[model samples]
Target: VGVERTFPVHTPVIDEIKIITRGDVRRAKLYYLRELRGKKAKIKEKRDIRPGAKAAPAAKAAPAAPSEA
Candidate 1:
């Protein structure tokens, strides 16, 4: 009985490396933007008097009855 193992190999190709680097940079930028947005949201919540609370609806006045001529 014999055990066989297979290992994946990557070629030292310049184009492939450049493509992989671009993908890494794009992912990093997306992650940074997401984190920044989350921090801004937290800051905004802190500034709010009631976080996650809904604003009270404005009271609407009923129309006055027309005056008889």
Candidate 2:
């Protein structure tokens, strides 16, 4: 896992912080997030939401076949 990573989540300066939904990460390395969008986003709720917060409802997931990395 020490593969020199630069996550955009680091050092952020934003007004609103948001967790669209909790993701059911099956794999530690989610290469899947790269090939999804719009109605195709699919992540399972696997955590307790913070106080006064609600996990966003997911739109219809696009029926996309898993792509090769």
Candidate 3:
């Protein structure tokens, strides 16, 4: 049997996010094996940030040419 549960996690980069954890019921105990691993991988990828790094600036649009009547 399988069970699913929702957990709220707070992080600096993501603020707060709800993660659904799944596990298998064995011997009346829930064993969460894959859910934790997957969550860790996802959070690692998202939280990969360098300190003192700046984001690239967006390009500005060119001014439209004056319409000649």
Candidate 4:
């Protein structure tokens, strides 16, 4: 996050300033993530959206059945 650069308004900088992520953020800022690390740095997952959208269940698969003794 230690990025520093400058761009003139006359240039085509729309793509650079645009919001690439369309997340439904409940909070206005995520500056706290900078202070966290690794898994702790992860933010709450948001359901993906599209024309035919579907929200995947957040569950882990059960372990396979043990073989017969």
Best-performing candidate as measured by TM-score: 4
lDDT of 1 at 5: 50
Kindly give the stretch of ten consecutive residues in candidate 4 with the minimal lDDT sum.
Answer: 52-61
Task: Sort by lDDT, best first.
Answer: 2, 4, 3, 1
Query: What is residue 69's positional error in candidate 3, in angstroms?
Result: 56
Clash list (residue pairs), candidate 2: 24-44, 40-62
**Residue 49 lDDT, candidate 4, scale 0-100:** 59
TM-score of 4: 0.38
lDDT of 4 by residue, 1-69 (tens): 556355785686455665444644567987776678787766665666564343333233446689998
Off by over 4 Å in 4: 1-11, 14-25, 49-51, 54-69
Task: Report the CA-based lDDT of candidate 2 relative to the real structure.
Answer: 0.62
Q: Candidate 4: count the clashes.
A: 0
List model 3 lDDT by residue over 18-51, tens digit each. 5454333334533445456544423212332575
Candidate 2 ranges with C-alpha deviation above 4 Å: 1-22, 48-69
Across 1-69, the per-residue lDDT of candidate 2 in tens digits comes to 224455465555555658666677778887776667766656767777576333343333346589999
Model 3 stretches astray by more than 4 angstroms = 1-10, 25-69
The clash count of every prediction, one per candidate, is: 0, 2, 0, 0
